[model samples]
Structure formats: C-alpha cells, structure tokens
Target chain A: MTHELATLEKQVADLRAKLEGIERRVPSNKLSMVVFSGDLDRALAAFIIATGAVAMGMDVVMFFTFWATPILRDPAKKVEDKDFMGKMFGTMLPKGACSVKLSKMNMGGLGTAMMKNLMKQKNVASLDQMIALAGELGVQIYVCELSMELMGFKREEMIQYPAMDFCGVAKFLEEAMDSRIQLFI
Target chain B: MSEAIHADKVMDLKGLPCPMPVVKVSKGIKEVAVGQILEAQTTDPGSLTDFPAWARTSGNEIVETIQENGIIRIFIRRKV
Candidate 1:
C-alpha cells in the first residue's frame, strides 16, 4: 500500500509539471476580429480593437468580408475593368478606408467628412493611420477571397500592405479557433 | 514637479483618444529596456482604466498614476 501511494504521488507530480510546461508553451493571448461592416464607425471600431489587442502583446487577426472588403481597397486605385453590374456596385461603394460611408446620418458623404474632421481634431488616429499602425504592429489583415470574388474585386485593386492577405473562410475560422478574443464587427 | 519620479522615457500622447494612448504606450514601451520606467502623458479620460488594464495583461508594472488639469500621467515598468 505504501509503495502504491508513493507511485501515485510521483505520477501526479509529473502530470502537474507537464501541464505547467504545456501552459507555458501555449499562446493564450490572441484576438480575431471578423469585420463584416463597411461603415466608417464599425471599421474604426474594428481597427481600434485590433490595435488595442496588439498593444497588449496579443496576436491579432482581422478578417474582412462582404462590404468590409472595401475597407482594404486602395484609395488611389480605381477599378475600371469589371462587368456593368460590378462597375456600378464598385462606383457606388466607398473607395477605401478614407472614404467609407458612415452607417447613420451620412448626409450624402458630409457626415463622413465631419466625423473625420472630428477624429482629426481630437487627435485620434485616422482609419488610414490605424491601418498603418496595424501593419507596424504585425496585426494580420485578411480579406475573404469569396467575398472578393462576389464583389468582382481583384487583388490588385486593394492596398498592397505587407500585413494584408487574401484567404477563405476556413483560414479565418482556423485562426479564430485558437484566439482568446473573437469579435464580429 | 520636484516630487515627480524619474522615468527612463517619456511619451506624450496628449489629445489622443481611446486606444491610441494604449497603442502608443505599447509601442513606446519597447524603447525602454526591461526594468526601466516609461512615463506616458495623455489627455484621454479612458486611460484611467485602459492603462492599468493594459499593464495588467501585458505583464508590465504600473508603478504610479497621476492626474492633474485633465492630463493623466502613467509610469510603467517593463517586466518582459
């Protein structure tokens, strides 16, 4: 009985040590953001959360889909070679992060300009600045390939930032599975 | 001012809003060596909670926090 008890104690100690090792090795600080809205406010919120998480030494991944894909578009590039419907939609959509329409009270683009000015006056980083900061901080920005296809957006039409990549839903889900913070914005 | 503690590096984030202060602090902290102090000055009201919360999660130490005339100062020590 005494020998059995000693062996059990040893086994428990070994298991505890192993668990501690695993815990130390596993990365517990991760944030995954699913950006599904193209609204200026929502995009700002998403980037804010991502930057905050990255500041806390957490790995951050932003997955852009649907209307949110426009947030990744290059402000300088105009999409010209698409089907009639695609061109119509593209022309109607906001060009990029700097031009994203507000979700409410846009007032034919005036609200967006007003909001941008307010953010600027308040010294808050603009969406473009936030995106740049995200790049600097190694925050991964992934655009959903399916969404891009549906929207008739070519990869060349998007901003060519180092942190930005094109991926499918599976990639987003894979990253999200291990993230401690998952947000849908 | 004479009673103020010394910091290895001082970051001015005045007039910045939520998340910017924290983001800038995080970036600025890297310039400080481990065990060194970083002082961040911000006008944002949110830093009251944001700074402490950030320090707690990022394995850093907040040695002191002071607010006066709507400006907030946080002294943090890098742990890792």
Candidate 2:
C-alpha cells in the first residue's frame, strides 16, 4: 500500500475509535445524596427524593453520614461489645427511623404524632414506606464508617436493607463526581 | 382537553402528593412499550408543573395534559 494511504487509514481508525468512545460513554444520570440530618422530616424528604429519582430511571446513591446513620438503626437489635460511650450514644440518639423527632414543632412528640396521623389520612407514604420503596426501587445506601465509629453505631444494629454498605466519604465523593444531581439533607 | 386520547396504560393517582404522583407516573411509564402512551390522572396541584418537568428530564415525552373538574390528566410517551 502507499505510505500516504497508510497514514490516511491510521487517521481514519483513530477518529473511529474516538467516536466509539463518545458513543459508549455513560450519561450523567446518577443522583447522589449526602444525608446529614437525623430529623424525621428530613429523612422523609431524603427518601422521597431518592425514590422519586429511581422512578425517573436514575441511579441513586445515598451516603448516610453523621447523624443520618442513626436513622437506619434497628431499635430491637443491640450489641454487647459496645463501650460506655458507644452505649451512651446509642441510648441518646434516635434508635430507628420511626423514633426520629421532627426538626420543627415536635411539641414534645405530639406534633410528630399528629403529622403521622395526618399523613395516614391523606394517604401519603410514611417514612418506613418510603424506605421500603427506596429499597424496592434499587436505591443504594452507603453508611459513613467514620460517623459510625464516632457515634458508636454497629453494623449489626442497622435495619435489614438490601443494598446498604459501610464506606467512607471518598465513596460519596466518587459517586457525586459522576452524578447529575447531588444533595445534602 | 376536549377529547380523549388512546393510551396503553392508565394510572389513577388521585390523592397522592408530590413525589408519589411523579413516582407512580415514572413507574407507570415502564409498564408500556416504547412509543406507547401512559396516562396519569391526579388531583395533586403540583403535578401541573411536575409532569412537564419530569418528562423533560426523564427523556419521556408528554403527549398532552388535560385539566378539568379538579383532575389533571397527563399523557406521556416512553422515549427511552
């Protein structure tokens, strides 16, 4: 073959490869959440947004950091290996999703109860139902290991969720970098 | 608003609030094949803006939206 033709062929192949790379590239359609609030209203908002994102056919990854990790704890499950601080933290923090207090107008738990009753009457999905829906919709949850260590939360104390794992903030950043939507709640 | 549309599926999401209506609509769109229409009927006031905005981002097409008698009906086509 001619040298000029060979050079032209190489250029064609390079262009084709670049085009293929662009064609097969993944879209920026993923959503990431940095959940830092432990309030019941905030938790409900996080899960609602999560479930809605999944419904929109977007991949959702929630990083449960800081106070948010306690929302996933199981009230009935207890570990015997906890130190004094761990035990104290476990006792003081909200045990589960259901036990979380409202960030506003808690009114000594009466406001929370009234809100729950109103939601039931309005046919709005509760926090528990939203969590189940989030799970069913394939929402991935990452518990911050650092937060868990500081808060004295054990992995075994978390509720039985399908796609939950303990990870660091780096994982949250990695997921967030590729996501189209990122929120802190 | 004056006539009825032919849709492959229909969802009556009447009392559901913000996220549920869109969530159900998103779920409902999956039940039908590509190019087919899915109609969602709701009473939620937010759905007026939600349906259009959701369809835009989700890559679905809203064929039409009808509002009458305190009911908002959104017809969407699954594009992807």
DockQ of each two-chain model: 0.82, 0.67
True contacts kept of each: 0.90, 0.67
Residue-level lDDT of model 2, residues B1-80, one tens digit each, is 56678989889999888699998888778899999999899999999888888998889999998899999988898898
iRMSD, model 1, in Å: 0.9
For candidate 1, lDDT tens digit of each residue in A15-89? 999999888666557999999999989998998888889888899999999999988888788766799767876
Among the numbered candidates, top lDDT falls to: 2
Model 2 per-residue lDDT tens digits across residues A15-100: 99999988656547899999999999999999988987887779999999898889999889988999999999999999988899
- For model 2 the local lDDT of residue A149 reads 97
Q: Model 2, A179: alpha-carbon shift in Å?
A: 1.4
User: Backbone clash tally for model 1?
Assistant: 0
Deviation in Å, model 1, residue A96 alpha carbon:
0.8
